[model samples]
Target: MSTPLWIFDTTLRDGTQGEGISLTAEDKVKIALKLDAMGVHYIEGGNPGSNSKDIEFFRRVRELNLNAKLTAFGSTRRKNSVCEHDVNLKHLIESGARAATLVGKSWDFHVHTALQTTLEENLAMINESLAYVKNSGMEALFDAEHFFDGFKANPEYALAALSKAKEAGAAWIVLCDTNGGTLPGEIGEIVSRVVREIDAPIGIHTHNDCELAVANTLAAVAAGARQIQGTINGYGERCGNANLCSIIPTLQLKMGYGCVSDEQLKSLTGVARYVSEIANVHMPVNQPYVGNAAFAHKGGIHVSAIMKDSKTYEHIEPHLVGNKQRVLVSELAGQSNILSKAQEMGLDVNPENMKSREVIDRIKELEHQGYQFEGADASLELLLRDAYGGTAQAFIVDSFKIMVERTGGAMVTEAIVKLSVAGEQVYTVAEGNGPVNALDNALRKALVQYYPGIRDIHLSDYKVRVLDEKDTTAAKVRVLIESTNFKDTWSTVGVSSNVIEASWEALIDSIRYALLGMDKDEYVPEFVGGTHGLSNH
Candidate 1:
């Protein structure tokens, strides 16, 4: 039988210590509920005494009645301070948490230099503080800060700290690699020794300074640690804490240790995304287990094999983690890449026919011309449809113009747009902070009356890349625009010698893609002009 293992999530506590991460009282409560639904064993919430905001979060979570034990975090009673009257301890008890985890100095160097206290006094603090919490009816967990480093330096003193915590009725002895500098081998050896000597259950906590937090945690588990302390998506101070996203799947699927149910495991991707969304952090596309590119196959050979047997290039089924395999078409693509990508986009193209052959040729030619379709799916869709002569000619852009001037020592920009829609000409003019803004405003103002969906479309991001530097100021540029209709976001790219023209191409594609998903009743006009701009061929 598999040994019983517990997952303790500390995302709300340590995760917030990450440089760009911050959560409100309501945010932490929401994350706690999500963890409970995901079947984690415990959630190490923030310290209510240090941050007043945490007090409100604990109060709010009480009404939630979460299944996972809510644990409060704090430092062991201040040096030479009484446990009963410790303000931090009082806040922890009043927070109404089910568990208390107090971190104490386990390294003799920290006891002398950092805390300015003797090793014996530090042991007394850990014992008394944990004893106070246990007596207050809260399960006490002692976090031995710097235990691995301390054990390496002075093995006897570190063992004495764990013994003190065990004697004080600590339900779990958590060995923490506080500095995040310990390697996996050291973690495994130290945890294995600690597990043999400590009477209480053992837990492992690590940081990612060396990018080995996950590896170190797994090593500890192999060494007989029953509890694993980590954060979702690896959010924490410095390089971050151990990533529960990678650890959970490895433990349950590969290591034969069950942490969550099979069904709950499928929600791993969703949970990582949800916390990322709430934290307003940009989820790395290459993050293991739950990233966009985790299972994506870009190489033609890889994609072809994945089509026959996904096991060829993938370690596990993508659906197991709620992510789907993506086939990307690029200059390095083959017939299989084109056909797979086209079919995925709902285009009526097949591998048996010569249609994918033509698409592949055109894609390579375009890539040679500084047009990349890998990251711009919206533009790629339009290009593919154009090849089949199925692209909808929604409207025609006859011409546009921009003017910039300085009046009263302030720069002003204006744009004029002329369009042909349904055999009728529509003209509009607008002013903006810049030429791109003016053009965007003018174009949208002209089309919003015909396509109400245009009103819903908003440009979220716009980036421009210089394709050549030898020409200096007269270099070809590529523009990538990310637009969203509040429901879905898509990206389009355009390349040209002029930045304005490149921006126009991407801006038009953004509008065209937005209208494609809108009401079909939108006016599709018969226009008199070229079907697309110079860059569209």
Candidate 2:
């Protein structure tokens, strides 16, 4: 029999402590649903006493029929105040959460200096808070803030604090690496001792200041901690909290712990990406398990070996976590890379085909000219389809023009695009805040009528990199545009000396890819224009 390790996610609470991470009530609800669907044991909704947003989140979350228990976070009562009289404690109880977590100072230094209170008084605060929550018929968790440091400084005081919480009915005694400076060896040793002393279940919450949050968490689990507290994508204050993305797979696949169901584990990658998308954060390509580059093979030698035996390179199957193996095309790629990539894209092509060699040579030549296809798989697919003569031209740009002018102390930009779709000429003009926006507006206005599916496509991200910084304005710039139809996302790239030209090239490729994947029967013209009118030119 395997010991069950509970996954306690604090993404909604501790995660928002990360710099630039803010979540609306709706966003929090959406993430909670995703976490519940992924079989997380507990979801710390938010600190109910912090702000109106979090208070509202607790209220809104009650309406959700989630499988995971919702936990409300708060601090222990003030120095001399009774737990019943504390407003923070009142809010936590009124939040209607299934569980309540109260963080109290455990370190003797913090008790004496930070709180300016006696160690005995701090112990009373932890005990009284947990006792009150437990008496109210709710599960009480005591978070001993800075436990590792506290234990090292005064093991007597730290163990006394845990003893107090347990005696006062804390269901779980959580040790927090608040400063995030503890190593795995120290965590394992300390956790082993704490488990021997504390009678209740143990939990671990760690920060990533030393980049050892995951390591320390696993150490605690190895030493008998039953619960792991962390956030999705490691979003939290300072260096962030432990990443459940890495922790979940490690616990289930590597350690043989039944942290989540097999089906829930498979949704890990999609859920990670979903949370990042809702947080408006760029998903790191190299993130472990669920990242774009996690199982991506780029080198020729690596691709050759992986094609023959994936076990030679891959640690685990990508599909286990809802991620697919990617074969990237680049200057470093060989003929085998091309064939493998083609096969992954569902293209039937022989390795000996001359067209495969031509495509490989063309990719290398284009890369030499500053076009990198590694991050632009959509563009590479379009190139291959065109070379194979299997893709039909979506539209042809007859001409386009952009105008920038200053009017009444304000800069105004407009674009005129003339294009032919299915032998029909359509000319459109639109104004925007910038040249790229103007071009995007004009192009979408023209194509939305012919292909209503294009209306669903929108630019999610745009990035520009200069090939030669020394050349300044004359340098060739590479523009990468990420477009999405709310269901799928793809990246396309373009390079040119002129910034506008490069942006336009990437934008055209984006539109072409969006239109190429649409079913003709799904085209329904729905006008979505108002403030700035779309005009026929």
Which candidate should be chosen as best, given TM-score against the real structure? Answer: 2
lDDT tens readout by residue for model 1, 311-409 = 999888877876667776789889878777776656787567787788788888878878877777777766666665545566788889999999999
Q: Estimated TM-score per prediction?
A: 0.84, 0.93
Q: Mind sharing the TM-score for model 1?
A: 0.84
Residue 144 shift from truth in candidate 1, angstroms: 1.4
Model 1 RMSD, rounded to 1 decimal:
4.2
Q: After superposition, how far is residue 475 of candidate 1 from its true place, in Å?
A: 2.1
Model 2: lowest-lDDT 10 consecutive positions: 526-535
Worst 10 residues of 1 by lDDT: 523-532
Evaluate all candidate structures by whole-model CA lDDT and list the values in order.
Answer: 0.85, 0.87
Candidate 2, residues 1-537, lDDT tens digits: the string is 667999999999999999989999999999999999999999999889889999999999998878998999999999988987899989999998999999999899999999999988999999998999999988999999999999999999999999999999998999999999999999999999999978889999999999999999999999999999999999999999999999999988989888998899999998998888888887788999988789988999999999999998999999888888888999888988888887775677977669888888888888888998899877777676555554444566778999999999999999999888777999999999999999999999998887787777788899999999999889999999988765566788888899898888788778766666774344311111110111121
Question: What is the C-alpha local distance difference test score of candidate 2?
Answer: 0.87
- Candidate 2 structure, TM-score to reference: 0.93
What candidate 1 gets wrong by more than 4 Å, as runs, is 1-4, 385-462, 481-491, 500-504, 507-537
